[model samples]
Target: MNNLGFFKNPTQITYGMGAANQLREIIDAQGFKNVLIITDGGIVKTGLIDQLTRQLDGIHYAIFDETKPNPTVTNCDDAMLALKQINADVVVAMGGGSSIDVAKAVCLLATNGGSIAGYEGIDTCSNDLLPLVAIPTTAGTASEVTTFTVITDEERQYKLTVGGIRLAPKWALVDPLVTKSLPSHITASTGLDALVHALESYTSKMATPISKTLAREAIRKISSHLRQAVYNGDNMVARDNMLMGSLLAGLAFNNTRLGNCHALSHPVSAIYGVPHGVANSVLIPHVMEFNSLAVPELFSDIAEDMGENLESLTLMDRAVAAVDAVKKLSKDIGIPTTFAEFKVDDSQIDRMAKDAMLSGNIAANPRITTYEDVVALYRKSIGGALVEVV
Candidate 1:
């Protein structure tokens, strides 16, 4: 293990059941006059926007709710236009990862005076972004506290990953109550996404003591509470635990980066338009099976955290049990195990593998992955074949 490690999380996170009610006060304390609310049509339709507006009765704000599930550069450009038109001093993102990612792109463009494409890689943006306050209505992505934003480029047919400490939100208001109204599928997909994040980060080559601690706890919380949260959306305790799990997973990945699961899932979402969480959910077990060859001890630790009884198992067996546990949990939560469920076929596997290899995340994977390895994993994922790890 490397003795030298680095950790950085500049976002001030406030988490609780009713933490969102303090939004107005938080904004006031930040001394912001005009706030631009970036979210999606679903959030507006659900009356969450109205509820927030009511809380900020005297605050000056404008709403831009055109964000899509997989946000595009056009979405960021439109939001930037809205921010400029309203002359907002601060930006508030009040939805899932999409809204927050759009807001991050808009904020980056607002101050940096350029298109989102220019800031695609790590530390590409030198200027400080406009102050951003993220309030998550879903328990996944944890875009609220992370330093990464994924914006799709429709013209190029790719998802652009923007990273740097400069991209971290100024504040994260995590209210589990906000996730209480999420649909079951959303809960299941997002919760499983959180689980994948924990598992991938725990075994990442960049994993540190700090990140591993957070990742292990996140795995435990998601394993114990994700099902209850999905089955009973009204269960505040489960919702709270899932939200905390998501946040901790975000923190882990934010510091240490992720692994093959995320590296591969990005291309699937970019090409197939699959929801990020669902794609990750489907690919995680397959990636785990492949990655365990490089990190069996870490996978064994994950098996224990996932509630697997590995009493008499060898390290390799325990690692396989971890993959099995993830598969079982994903199936129990109604996440499709095969890419065929999303209508993906083998035609695009080669191109997707190439794109997946381009992700910086591939370098952080515990295993030294090749283009051929990625192609095999993609095939295994699409065929729903649980190949044994050598």
Candidate 2:
């Protein structure tokens, strides 16, 4: 396979400052009724639901707002119950990846019938789901448009990606205005998440020309705008760029897939309750270092995209520059530089490593990795000390 393989994106995308307000008209045009609005509690507090409701005049609806930051299969069960009770014809998700993932799971299981785990891995669902509309509150994860939906199985203690074209949202309403009021820390973590998406996708074994193009642009936009978006939450220009970056990264990773950074980060999140973006931020530099040998040229391209020198430096040196740039951006935006900062224990490393190796994301890493590699990566991340590259 000298030439990169196939690529596809099936979601209907709408972008701009207030695109979410268009949800009702879009849903109506799709001939969907009895909408089930799924979200986390925080988004309800923002009163954006009121704006959503205003547009949904004739649509019958119900709200399920119990989604947590890391959505679990149990969350899907709860939402499914609500869907059945409400007899919802269309599922609308509002808020972060947790809510969106839950919505995706609910939509699938509602029609497909099984535990969310059965759909784990690729294209397991044989049937079409009810139409789903995704309206994202956070600019991270880009879960709104992607075919991937991660739901935790508490019994198994792993974050599983249940992916298929069937899980892709029928409509993706991206409204950057909703992000303008986000607090600084959230802006930092989620912004870093978007960066990780682009980086991982760019270096993924499955990378295609389309995905690479989108990932490169996503990396540049996120690197240039994430800090500004964090420092100045009200700056629409920064918010817009960050929003676009998050979407492009979502599109990129959705096709090309993610890598070891996400693989290692998942266990930290599953075991420690660390936010996904925060975990990615802490592990990205170390994982990049480990994988650099396999894809040095890719990292060199990444450095240039991140506005660093790529011409004179050797590939390894440029790889180091990429890591350095990520660290600097993380620090500037107040992202915790170490996993230990979250109060996770060294004793937990073995379990975390085992779980990381099982993540589907690990398979897409350019470098073939082992459980020992994941453990060392965890140890390196917990140390919080930056590595110096010669």
Global CA lDDT computed for model 2: 0.87
State the C-alpha lDDT per candidate. 0.90, 0.87
Q: Which residue pairs collide, candidate 1?
A: none
What does the lDDT read for residue 146 in candidate 1?
95
lDDT of 1 by residue, 1-390 (tens): 565499888999999978888888887788888889999998898888888888777778899999999999888999999999989999999999999999999999988988898789999987999999999999899999999999998887899899999899999999998898899999999999988889888998888999999999999999999999989999999999999999999999998889888888988898889999999988898889888988899999999998999999999999999999998999899998887767887777877888889999999999999988998998888884333322
Off by over 4 Å in 1: 1-4, 384-390
TM-scores, all candidates, are 0.97, 0.95
TM-score of structure candidate 1: 0.97
Candidate 2, poorest ten consecutive residues by summed lDDT? 381-390
lDDT measured at residue 220 in model 2 versus the true structure, 0 to 100: 93
